[model samples]
Target: WFISYALDEYFYFGIFYGMILVFSFYNLIMFIAIRQKQYLYYVLYNLSVGFFEMSTDGIAYQYLWPNAPEWNQVAYAFALCATSIFALLFTRELLFVKAKAPRLNQLIIGVIVIRLIFFIYCYLFNQTLFSFKFIEAIPLSVAFFTGIYIYKNGYQPARFFVLGYSFLFAGFTLKFLIMLGISWLNFGVVSYYSLSFCFVLEMVFLSFAIGDKVRLLKLKKDKAQQKIIKQMAINAKLKDTVNQELETKVEERTREVYHKSLIIESKNQALEEANSLLQKQAEEISRMNVLLEQDNEELQTSVEKVSRDRVMNTEVDFEEFSKIYPDKESCYGFLAELKWSKGYHCRKCNNDHYFSGHILHSRRCSKCGYEESVTTYTIFHNTRIPINKAFYMIFLIYSSKGKISSHKLSELLSIRQSTCWTFGSRIKKVMDERKKTLKKTGKNGWS
Candidate 1:
């Protein structure tokens, strides 16, 4: 196979194998660093696919095992079996087929087991047992369909898987057609170079698929954490609000209680003071009542003394006044005695003779024919108050110790204050004149 191909082609194949080795070893290290099963599956899938391509293209025969040409006969078949097993396992892990696509997972397992059995049979029997072309097509096709199904169901990483498998499927179909002597699709490019290019694309696409899966997982985790943090913030704010409201309510209640307590204390103080004042007032009222009773006894004794002192004079109490001046005629008779203490005499003729006038309570002089009234030349002359009231006023004036106000005099006499003032002033003026005359005439000319 090397004798037919050019030296440039060998160089190209070497570079392609170097790339595959780099991808394989890098992913294997990633599996060790991260300890993820998907990384391990990717590493194994890359190694098995690269080995199958090399064995089919006669590269392994020339460089890897030159001394054992007989090994070439079964190398491609064994590599194919290994490739199928790892590819299916990687697909199962990548798409989460065991959980999400269980039927697909079972089908892949069955294919892997059947291929392993066939590989073992080929190894033991030393025969080219069955055509390995359809066996090779089965796993690639299943992986492609699985990518489509999972991608349709919204798996974001499956698009890369589908694209990577499409390239591998194309390579496998072309190689199969060439083995059956259909070489028109090769179109001047060697089948091995085409297969190498397709293998490189498959590796890149599969690596992107794994990277995409990681990115999506990280995005989901970050979103869930953000949601939890936001919820915690909301709860904390609600707690703060509740605490603030509780504090405000507490302050209000405290103020209200304090105000009410002040009002109650003031009221209690006022009530206590009022009770003390009432007790003092009760004691003072009791003393005043005793004094009032003593005053009444003294007033009665003074009245009896004044009555006894009036033995030679006319008494002016109610009984004495009624006996002396029971009617108008008796009142005139008393006024006549006070007016003229001496015998009646004529004013013009100086004759000491009198006769009764035709009018009642009037006297006429017979010597000069002059008439006179019993009230003439007395304070009762021209009085608007009744004669009885005039006598009472005179008695009250003489008995009172202090000067009485007109209001008190009017209240006692049951007369108007104006009338009491007029009568009292007139009587006081008359008594003052009489006192002056007595001083000048030695009290003898008053009569």
Candidate 2:
């Protein structure tokens, strides 16, 4: 029965140590991958738990059971103290509460230091510093209350921390109860297994928390990218609208400028036409003046020749003849002859055969009884002024080249400025009407 129990003990120890070695390597790799201080703390915590489990297992069952080793009690006491410190550090790191309370950390450190000093003194003097059994359970109580405080504070990671510490505290509590003569299960086996199982579950929970944190970070990154893409799309649409509006404005301005250009071109064309008409009238007036000058010179020469012939009596008779005759009939006949160089035709009958009836200074055409006058279709028609006066008005208008002011023309013509202005306006209106009529006729293929 003793050998069987020894073998069972060895097998359990092997299993526990094997698990610790495997978990240690796993946590070490995780620590490297994560690189966060929290993960590092977990790695240290796991290592410490493994060390305590392996050491206490050896001391409690293998080294001190049946027959105690030489320094069994002293070694176990030192191991217990070390284990308490490790538990305090692990719980503090896991809960994230130690950073908020500096005093707690100082108190824990002070307790560990005092315990260490007492433990060393006891080992050297062979005299205990307060009883070993009495202080051995103190770390358990401290761990339990710490776990409760962490849980009450709503620390999420504290759940695993509290559970791991609870397993350890229960293990120690059972041992304490058993030492005080309490009859229960085997404390050694139960404590080791419970502590190991709790550690495994704690590691699993920590891995899940780290993964959750990573997933949340990724989600936040994706949301930021989506927001940026949405903003870029909105900016692109605004730019397109602004560009289109600018293009529309440019097109409108270009059209307005083109319209103004066309208006200017029309005005230029009208001015060119008026200038051409003035130039032609000027040339006609110059030719008419030249002809009048030649006729006047010829008359002066004829009179001088008659005076040189010494015909005083004939000169007097010629003067009396000029006075009596005045040659108004001859002038009228000459004008008629010039006007009807083409044979006269009766307008009503549309016939070339026509009779001329002399009535003093005028001639009447007798064919369908339609009377004809030499000046009827000419510029001299229906004028109350002398022919010379009418001719002078035409000459003045032609000489001024269409630039003469109406007031200036009235003064030159010895007519009221209002009458001159009215006549000039009427003439301009008639010219415009004729031009429009000619343009319409040309469009219709008429001469």
Q: By lDDT, who's the top model here?
A: 1
Instruction: State which candidate has the highest TM-score.
Output: 1
Worst 10 residues of 2 by lDDT: 310-319
| lDDT of the candidates, in the order given | 0.76, 0.58
TM-score of 1: 0.55
Question: Which segments of model 2 are wrong by more than 4 Å?
Answer: 59-82, 98-155, 185-447
lDDT of 1 by residue, 204-299 (tens): 999999999989999987876676567668768866776676567556755755665575456556656787666665555556556655655675
lDDT of 2 by residue, 1-447 (tens): 999988997787676667656766776787686565555555555566665565556735554354756555455565556656665655555455467556666666676677778777887886565245568456556656766775687645456555655665565566666667776555565553665665566555555554554566678778766765676687688667766765675567557556655754565566567776666655554565566556556655654554433322222332333332234444455467877788777667766665665433344546577777766775556655344334344434443434567787577657777766665554445445665787887742111
Q: After superposition, how far is residue 27 of candidate 1 from its true place, in Å?
A: 1.7
